[model samples]
Target: MKKTAVKKTASRRPRARLKKSPLPFVDPAGQNGLNPEPPRAIFLEQPAVYPGTAPKAPGFELPPDYGDTKIALFAKDPWWLYAYWEVAEPDKAREAIRGLGLAVQRTVLRVYELATDSRAAERVSFFDILVGSTTGDWFIDVGQPDKCWMTELGFVADNGRFFALVGSEAVRTPRFGVSDVVDEEWSFSSELFWKIYRASGRIGAGASSYDVRAVVIESWQESAALQKKQLLLKGEGPSSFQSRGSA
Candidate 1:
């Protein structure tokens, strides 16, 4: 009994570690302290900012600067707009030109529903109008758009003269199924743009898609900027683009 001594051993304990939850972003149940879960912020909770009236479009008569006016944005979020009145005629045409551009400008200033489907029918909540003269290049926008939608309807001359436009800002998340960030350029070639344009019909009534030039569209793994830059240099549409001449 004196020759052998009892050996002592330490008790083992479990270590604390955080693991990925099956429900995503949720902590495992019944762990340590019971902290209440934080609530999510809702964007739709805010009241929409829209005027009660819709600005009227000019009739079939085409003004002198109908398609030639230049719109320059001198500020961010673009508040101050400088409209260059380069009318071809004397006084009356200039007045009509100013009036027409002003009306279009007012409409563009306010956020309009650029989606064709009834607001309730579609999942989309809201949209803003981006009139042609509102941006730098005389199109919707010349750079990559963060979020947006387009509609089949647009502002125009009563004689069927068309005015270019884009829709309001969209909510951002990893949610858009067909959109790639870097693959987006100022032009509409991305799947996101096509889908929105196709559904919304940003094109004016009865206009042909044949006049719409294609831009190099990059897929999920492609570079949108590079493709657009290349298209800009080449003055050609994408490889898959087909001319919708009659259809």
Candidate 2:
């Protein structure tokens, strides 16, 4: 019969749970709390500035009309002329019609071909182009080169008479071929002429110097023969005189 000693244990109690914060916790070194690594950045070279840098150009816009009543003609090429015109306000047109005492029926562009450069010279020929009311520009096909031309913007009256509003200065179209002003005649030596001919590929690149010499000799002989033939045809040849002397 022995008495046993028993140990008493304390009752278990539930612990209180802590609420989570919505904001992220930051470290004193200004780094993310979850990822404690420092932030990284890439550096780039600074740009250079030049002393001759130009300022930005201002925006430019062309007005529809210059508010002046004028017609200008320009020669685009040997056979074409461009004409542009601007009519003043409607009141100006009415005033012009009243001053001329004519009722305008339609607009017209009259093209004139001057015979000479003299201001008092008459027009050799003229043609009319029927341009509508809304036309501001036109391309005229002159079909002739090296000619002086003039144009007038006008209106055909109801009575079939024409009234001019504005006239452009006469412009001369250029010729397509070589200029007529010849200062002097250019003559080249036979050796120089042959060199140019060879350079121009008339003589083949694969030809030897002897071949070039033969070609030049043949060309000279042919030219002399041609000159003799021409003299014989004209009845004034050395061959005819030699034959007469032989006879």
Candidate 3:
């Protein structure tokens, strides 16, 4: 008997298993699964202290603020004066320049010499300086001393017109000669020197005191000699002793 051919279907190919990407490891917050809240920032307010008052604790001090646009004038010497300024608001300065209706070429400092008589009109002098958004201190030779001076910082236009931005308070330049009065009542009194000499003589009557005074004088002389030698070595020229000896 011919048996029907057994039908053997091809074994089905095994299905491919898709591999998933591993998740990143995250640190667990606490024993509980909930995340902990972030810490809040704390700020302690400090009380303001006045100038002469003693503070409970030493605190940081801030520098003085002279407002948006400030100019100051200081006497450097009999002939020179120093001027410094600050521009706090650049936008305001730019707006002022725009209002001038002239192209600014550079920054100009106008120094006005007020009349000593106060009745005469102020004499104006100008100095041109190339400055940027910020400027440092500047020195100007104001010539004569013992005169009142004031300064104005401004922008000089290409058309030679100046737009004054800020002005400084008037300051007096010191005279070249002795401007301060000498206290001759105490300094030139012969009786006071005589009393001091008598007291020193009584105190230095002991041999020990004499020896100490001699030692102090010798030490002072030696230090003076060393300082003179150092100055000479630094190219300050010959000392009086050297000059005399050479002569």
> Comparing 1 and 2 by TM-score, which wins?
2
Q: Per-residue error at 15 for model 1, in Å?
A: 96
The all-Cα superposition gives candidate 3 an RMSD in Å to the true structure of: 26.5
Q: Which stretches of candidate 1 lie over 4 Å from their true place?
A: 1-148, 151-247
lDDT of 3 by residue, 117-219 (tens): 2414466544455554334568888788888888877777778877778888888788898748776422434544444455466545534556556655655
Colliding pairs, model 1: 60-159, 128-168, 150-200, 151-200, 151-201, 151-202, 152-200, 152-201, 183-224
**Candidate 2 lDDT tens digits, 1-247:** 9989888898888888898869777667756646555788988797766778757579997787777888889999999999999777745675678687777788889999998764356899999999875238999999899999999888788788877788888888889998887553243367757775785567767556676687767666766787788888988798779888999
State, as a TM-score between 0 and 1, how close model 2 is to the true structure.
Answer: 0.51
Model 1 over residues 14-50: C-alpha lDDT tens digits? 8878886664343457355455577888776766657
- lDDT head-to-head 1 vs 3, winner: 3
Ordered by lDDT, highest first, the candidates read 2, 3, 1
**Which one is best on lDDT?**
2
Backbone collision tally, model 3: 0
Winner on TM-score between 2 and 3 is 2
Model 1 lDDT at residue 210: 45
- Pairs with backbone N, CA or C atoms under 3 Å apart (clashes), candidate 2: none
